[model samples]
Target: MPKPSSTKKVKTIPVPKSIRIDLTGHQYGRLTVLGFAGYRESAPMWKCQCDCGTVADYYRCNLRSGTSTQCVQCRHADLGVRSTTHGQWGSPEYRAWEKVRQSDNVCKRWQSYENFRKDVGPKPSKDHQLSRKVTTSAWKPSNVHWVHRDNVVQQKSNSHLIRFRGRTQTLTAWAREVDLSPAALRSRLESGWTVREALTTEALH
Candidate 1:
């Protein structure tokens, strides 16, 4: 008699449970939900009409969490009006101020563009950005300064930089210094390789 052949059992993946929330005809801030737009990244999306008479698709979570309200046109309109009133609209200074304000990271006093200008004065160049001297602290006149974009980028990149071989540098910087691609170095790190091994390993052609 022929010996019985072994059969391998396959595991079935369970279907993900969907949590549905109906938001049709509901008003959230300046947005009125019209109907479902479809799914995005596995999350439900809704079609909404803004008070400005524009229709856009928004994530259901953003609508319910109050993250997004009006359309982009309305936001730009408000920024333009407020910035023009301060005589700094369309200027680099105004753009920097608007960036901070939109993030809701500004101090109450800075809410007024005039007050913000009075404190920060003006941007030295188009490449200058508003930066907080103490990042952990709130955005206040005394804690903020205008810094060159390059310096800001360096500071941010350096914050989470790694050190190897008694030399400290960002992953990109180290990769460039060693003639290795940054993406490859990152991939090695992600694959549980030690930092020293990741940086020193030769790329396979």
Candidate 2:
């Protein structure tokens, strides 16, 4: 039998372990990281609580990249959509809310979709719009309602401009803003009444 040739022995080097990032008690937008959740696809995830008190898990990349700032409800609230409770993200109501949610006319309380939905209720029909009784007034429960587009009042031109509450608009616009009657507002403007006076004066209603 032929003698076997001697072979050299090879040694393997140990790889260094990855350092895990500790994110406990870190706040990102409306979320506060509670602890490490687990790993997903070899990536780390974290458990977080939203400002609204909802808890959920998110990937570290999403939080660090600013992609997952808030929990589902709060995020959807900011987007004028619902989580699993209502309709889809791009629904008509979502589109309508998108147009006005950023405006100063929207009440700060409405920032929470829960409050908005509770006060305004659901959209009656696709033809309806979110409207305020006083066109220029901020959106609130008492003044807000769903009105059909066709039946809504036609806005007049900005011919007669009046400045109120650090903002300027036409008489028609001001009429919808404050509770003051249009006739009274026009009289006030024509009589050289200050915006504060017009907004603070007793209502004719």
Candidate 3:
């Protein structure tokens, strides 16, 4: 029979009997190793504080050397009530909205124009000229106009605009449904017709 090979035993450093930590020049006695966080692939390993007032300072190699330490625990109690709002802007849906909102010139111009008018009054002024710079490829000067609050709401109630069927419809179809010509509907919409009046007159016809 072959002779049994001798196995070398690895020695481990034992936790100290007690630990002391100085916080703001005052000595804290019961500080224990809580958790650890640092670059795993580099030097300057960190020590975690425990409940027993012990601190475990080991090298990154030492941490990998054994599995004694761990990262912080996820506290469920701390999470409290869940929020009903949307996720952060970095999420997929938010990112998609953000991409169009930021990059698409047509959408950007519409938003900017509306905001500008709301904030600093109607455009077409020397300063407001900048706001009019935005337009869709098909946008025309005659097709754009300021509308009153009531007229705006009236035009929005059309089935075409509201989408009664599975498919989405256009403003032109809504206008046609109410017996108003496309030019008339566009005129009213651009002039700020309300959804209520727009839908009523269109539907009545």
Candidate 4:
């Protein structure tokens, strides 16, 4: 009988240890790292305390990336404020208000639902959105109005409007009229092209 072939044993590689960083006493946004919670799925976790007096576990990466902030109570409170402000949390009016507040950098004055409702009044319709009469103005009662969503878009579009050949239209509208992509036209404008050139330029296929 032929001699049995010698079998070569395969060597197993040991798993590399993860680099651990101590985040104790480090503040990330509203959270202060207290200690290491342990590991989950081969990643380190941390125990953190929020300024609002809540303690929770957060992924190590989330703290370092500024992604985790505030406790559950604060997050719920914020969502409640937004939802109660416009009769419902997921309403179109509330979402519109949120978008306007973020875009215009409106200060938060209406902490209570009553204050927000008293100032903004009731939502007229599902199709209506909170709008600012003056684009540069804040979301206060004096500056805000309930307008159709299309009207809001038109109003925002008017801000960057171009006037050429006795015609006034937004860059997007001009691009549509001239058979150019709105995104390409905007890019050209951003690159310092004149409105005429941006609107007139043919889009490359």
Candidate maximizing TM-score: 1
Candidate 1 C-alpha lDDT tens digits along 121-197: 87888777888675434578888888888898666555536677787777789779877776666554433345665
TM-score of each: 0.54, 0.37, 0.21, 0.39
Residue lDDT tens for model 3, 129-185: 221212222122332444344544444444224343454457677656767666665
Compared with the true structure, all predictions reach lDDT values of 0.65, 0.61, 0.33, 0.60
lDDT of 2 by residue, 25-125 (tens): 78888777777675433345677777766668776656765656777776556555344555546766656665556443567787665677777777899
* Candidate 4 wrongly placed segments (more than 4 Å): 1-74, 77-104, 159-205
Candidate 3 error regions (>4 Å): 1-168, 202-205
lDDT of 1 at 21: 54
Residue 60, candidate 3: C-alpha displacement in angstroms: 76
Tens-digit lDDT string for candidate 4 (49-106):
7776677877655566444666667766767765653456765555555454333235
Residue 71 displacement in candidate 1 (angstroms): 1.5
Ranking by lDDT: 1, 2, 4, 3
lDDT score of residue 86 within candidate 1:
58
Best by lDDT: 1
